[model samples]
Target chain A: MNQQVLIQAHQRIQPFIHNTPVLTSRLLDEIAGAHVYFKCENFQKMGAFKMRGASNAILSLTQEERQKGVVTHSSGNFAQAVALAANQLGVKSYIVMPKNAPQVKKDAVRAYGGEIIESESTPIDREEMADKIRIETGATFLHPSNQDEVIYGNATAAMELLQEHPDLDYLMAPVGGGGLIAGTALAAHYFGNNCKVIGGEPSQADDAFRSLQSGKIEFNDSVNTVADGLRTNLGDRNFPIIQQHVERIILVDEDEIIQAMKLIWERLKIIIEPSCAVPFAALIKERDNFKNKNIGIILSGGNVDVKNLPF
Target chain B: MNQQVLIQAHQRIQPFIHNTPVLTSRLLDEIAGAHVYFKCENFQKMGAFKMRGASNAILSLTQEERQKGVVTHSSGNFAQAVALAANQLGVKSYIVMPKNAPQVKKDAVRAYGGEIIESESTPIDREEMADKIRIETGATFLHPSNQDEVIYGNATAAMELLQEHPDLDYLMAPVGGGGLIAGTALAAHYFGNNCKVIGGEPSQADDAFRSLQSGKIEFNDSVNTVADGLRTNLGDRNFPIIQQHVERIILVDEDEIIQAMKLIWERLKIIIEPSCAVPFAALIKERDNFKNKNIGIILSGGNVDVKNLPF
Candidate 1:
């Protein structure tokens, strides 16, 4: 919402999340021909940046609200993030996951003490299940990427990165449901000394890229990218901020995403999900434009199935 | 070498290498039943702890020796380390690699500014090529693990670990050509309040284990382990120190190594070579022996070919 709100959110989640380290590789810098600082959220508590937003959102609640518990619909990292955050904050959490979700995902949610409410594989089914639980149990429903508090919480990562390297010329993040890039945009605008924000999206699922040009939320024509995380449409809550503050959204093809992801894994020596590599791929794709600038890239997550590597 | 020597080596190489971060996972701690501190040498320059030793060994050489440059026979992380370290320190380095070494590996060496001399795929032929280079150019021949300075430099990883986590009850590493474990044993003895050193070795490449029992260097009957880095036999210089200071060596079967390596890759979200997982595998095998104690594990390297993962 504002600088003060973002700062307060960071302080609130400080006790629960990691101020994950910023790593730089000379080889990676040389490859891109730019000074690249990787804010490694892959090392975040749940192996993703969602932990920051989840912790802040849950922590921002009143005692009475927290007592009633919180609910979310996700079959991805957000499910684990909310579960772990609630478990850490001594609050009950209910996760509405698709019945056909990966068993490992189900196990992780259960391991974090969250009760899983199964739904059909459709988005409408998942949302209905979450809404039903919220009504029946008087639980608060948390959106993965659309809420103000969650966006502010996600802003803290870019805030911390700016604090460490104040001279960054551009800050970039992968465009998913738009929370991370939207939050990152707000952070860059508020805290960065003229540091602009950019977004990276899969060409197959380039709704975020499309929404910026059309000035409204847009749906993907096909959600078929290897970056499973970036297939979602932008949220109303995050779209305006993205439109007002984000400099541009770069589109990378599936081959580019896999190639960049492999390069990060090999050169940075850190595992990252395909979605996380989108921004880096964009950087590599447009290397000449950003040849000598100080760039900060947020590696959004590392929660990938290593057994099924794209490369 | 003693405390001051290790400290000096660390100081000399500090500018060239990374003081790689220490990472922990609550899940991993629960699995091992011990509070574990992972000294992430996988994040080191050239993606291995060998950088520390290679930098130190080159730095310890006299200015005249440095001008003549350094030479070594190997087709592993050490070759890259020597090249990068020498390049950074403004010294020439000649790396003798077996003719059959992977093209990617040879490219990595060349990328690091090392001159590569091809040798026959035999120990005798490799050594002869290295000797020829030394004789022709007056370059200093640096053994990958056998020499005293290299061993002392290798010890700095453990030294830094002990400095950060002085209360570690036990320090562990995978025993390869014996330099890392030997250095670790000395670091624990000198810098640790009372920390003991332990090693993990592949059961197939059980030379280190046999040498400890027979009180001499021993050759492996078969070098068929997936941990390619740990296939070498112990060196004469490091063996005596290992025998004197190392409490014991734990042998892990290949299957166990793969399982533990996957756990680390999944849980820690960090890429590591198969050899790097050996110590953690050893810890999982002997979890009961180390229950509720503070332990530190040095992740030796992260230079594995992801395309050819063991899993």
Candidate 2:
């Protein structure tokens, strides 16, 4: 939206989030032939940038809404973020997850004080179940990535990065539901010094990339990608912002994603999930276009199942 | 060693080292029943605290010695630390690693611009090879953990930790060749508010603990431990420091180490090597002794081969 709304969202959610560190690696820089600054939201509270959005959404609610509680149907980082944020604000959270969702994800949500409502492993089932819970309890239904408050809240991370390094030439992030990239674009537009925002999307799940080309929301018919987090399609609330501000969307193959993920873990010595590596993969693939430029990559999250590493 | 030496070491190596972040996890603190502060050396320049000691050793060298270069025999963190530090300081480094050392370690040393010399897979063979190289090239042979300069270099970690939180009730580190623990003890003695230093040694490789009781430098005749980094015995230079200042040594088993390592990986959302988990393992094992106290644990390194994770 506007700079004022972004600032207000940050002010409201700052107490509940971590101003995560920006990390750099010489080897990584040398490999990509650019000065790469990683805005490590992997180290954020609940280990993702989603925490900022979750906190802001809950904090924006009225006293009556807060009393009723919040509801979200997510089997990823956003689920944990909302649960933890609500718990911190002393508000109840109802998380509707798929019946076949990873046990680790379910455990993490419960650990953060979320009440689980399991549905059949389908998008329709998840949405209907969450809607039922919302109707029953009169709870606020918060979309993981498509809400206005969430997008403005996510903008704070890039805002903080801009605050530290105002002259960054390019800001890059993976396009998963188009939320993070949209927020990053807004932050760069309002705060950066001649900065452009770029999105990295997996070729297997290329809905966001297609959405940009068609100037309309698109969906993947059959998603098949290793980056489990990037399979979701774009939504109306954030798609317009992305279309207006995002410079380009780079599509990378699964192999490149795995290579990028391994490099971060080995050189940066940080655990980042497959979705987090997508931007770096794109950077590597398009090194000539960005050679020697100052780049900022949003490492989206670090919640990987160590027992099932692809590398 | 005195506080002056520790301060001097930090000043000398400050340009070449990182003031790594001190991380806190509510879940980890709850598990330990103490307010635990993790001095994350895993995020250091070489992904370990060995960088501090290695850089200090190189920086402390005479002009002629610097020209002649430095050498060490290590198959672990110190090898890469020495290689990278020497490269950073514009000094040549010769690393004599055992033939059976992991190929990934060799690649890391070479990537850091160190000349590698392969020796037979034995302690004696590795030392003889390194000593021969030292004689041939007239290079200073810097022992991985036994030398005074290295110990003072290592002390800078605890010094930095104390600089951030000087009121810590205790400081904990894994006992490998006694260098880190010994340096930690010296730092706590001089800089902390009555902070007692504690050592975490694997019960399988309990040389340091036994040496304290026997009043002599002891050896682990059959070191059978999952903590490959802590298999080395206490050395002459650091044994006296450990004996004089360390409050107590905690010995934990293999299962406990794995559990502690998993907890840190899961809750702290950081990738720590098995060796780095030793101090936390000890903390979790001895929660009663540290309950409600402010404790600092030195996360030794994060160089585990992700291909073969224990958990």
Candidate 3:
């Protein structure tokens, strides 16, 4: 929760993660009416910012704990993140997924040395199976987002961005489980030159936006957004950080997300997922609010199915 | 082309173009069975390597010629390249695009300050219109791929790659208008540590491969290839250079091009045009020929229409 913890976490995970580049486009800058700097975590190892948190969590474990391995339940980027990080650190990883998960997703996890434990097509089923694995094998149960070490680890991305462009007026990131944005808020508070942190979320899954307004954790009744990454609810650990540090959560519609994503793909020549485009969509919606200012955007990941692109 | 011209071209275009990054992938290395280095011209200004040649051609113009401006006929990356380069040099650019050319492409040219002069949907019509503009305005007619200055300019890409990794055993590039590969061969000849240059081409549009074998300029009977950029025939200015310096031309089918492209998109997390994938396709096809060797591959461009992705 403090700057020292975040700093140490960054140092610990430094050797394992890439200090990904900050890219700028003149045309993009013109369209947004701001000097936009893109922190490209899409180019990170395992192709997301999740690698930082996973590496930090796995490395923080003791030799005996590492020998017993780690277990997590997710069908998204975190699965690959933990698998790759654990493999690199010479530790075993047990990934629990629903039986209906895509073959490609399961293959990717296995490719990174994850032992898959399939369960019924439900969250409770996944969690119970992961817990059973942890109890039976004495493996550490690592939460994908709602963990202190993971949040601190995720802060390193904004830390690197602030180090490169300290004069940024605002730092924008897409809110998934609030891990990346909470860490970003911490980074901006400690290292930025009076920079404010902002979060972007889909209106269809606007739990983070309502949570900020109500000053409490909120959950969507039904998730109907194309941003598959942002469909998860904010966690207890990250929700408190979000309430205290995050400035505001902006809501964008599905069309705007697709438009912003297309612009990045066409103008910046980079592949970014729908969740990554949420922040840029917010920028476009409120261009007048931040016109001519310097902004840093976290391109969260680039792990989309290319064959099923919306635009 | 000689070393001195390439060296001087690099110096002349240094301020105008980007010294694009060279990226490496461990997984990609394992798949190709070679230590692969990719020179990312996809990240270059105008999102293609054509900018290098365009800038060189425009910068090489005399003062009077600069006052008169420059003209070219095409609807591909070259149109945008010449427009952007001329705009940067403060010279007028007249772009003759076909009437049936895609609206997105024409808009790109105009966005770069090109004066669009539409002609009938035929190569001869475009050339005639460009020739008419040249006569009317006394503007210099710059061929997209057949000119000496442009070829020398394109060579700077391989020059940079060699400078960064001089011990490369082989250099590979996709053959389009023959500008990039001809220049790459010359660069390897002059700056490399005895590096052999190889060319990749589609069998559907195998003019360069046939031209190299037949000892003369040859044309494809029907240019039925998805690699839209490599459909042009080799020209007089570049054929001799290619013949003398290039080690071999490898032909790949359409399926191979798409497969290689998907692999790059999925693994490298970068968007590249189909033409750019031809070289990697060649490398993948001849994996045994390149195993355990250090090879440098030029990723030609990243200007694909996202809506029409073949994958």
* Alpha carbon deviation, residue B23, candidate 2 (Å): 0.5
| Candidate 3 lDDT over residue span B1-311, tens digit each | 45788899999999999999888888899999999999999999999999999999999999999999999999999999999999999999999999999999999999999999999978899999999999999999999999999999999999999999999999999997899999999999999999999999999999999998899999887789889999998889999999999999999999999999998988888889999999999999999999899999999999999999887
Candidate 2, residue B157: Cα displacement in angstroms equals 0.2
Clashing pairs in model 2, backbone N/Cα/C closer than 3 A: none
- Candidate 1, residues B184-295, lDDT tens digits: the string is 8989999998898999999999999999898888999999999999999899899999989999999999999999999999999999999999999999999999999899
- State in Å the error of residue A2, model 3: 2.6
Alpha-carbon error at A22 in model 1, in Å? 0.4
> Could you list the iRMS of every candidate?
0.7, 1.2, 0.7
Candidate 2 lDDT, tens digit per residue, B1-311?
46788889999999889999999988778888999999999999879999999999999999999999999999999999999999998899999998888888999999999999999988899999999999999999998899999999999999999999988999999999888998899899999999999999899999998899999988997678878899998899999999999999999999999888888887777778898899999988889988899999999899888778888
lDDT of 1 at B217: 87
Fraction of native Cα-Cα interface contacts (under 8 Å, chains A and B) also present in model 2: 0.53
Model 1 chain B weakest 10-residue run by lDDT: B1-10
lDDT of 2 at A299: 93
TM-score of predicted chain A against the true chain A, for each candidate: 0.99, 0.99, 0.99
Instruction: Report the Cα lDDT for residue A163, model 1.
Output: 97
Query: Which residue segments of model 3 deviate by more than 4 Å?
Result: none
Give the distance in Å from residue A175's predicted Cα in candidate 2 to where it truly belongs. Answer: 1.0
Best by DockQ: 3
**Candidate 3: how large is its RMSD?**
0.9
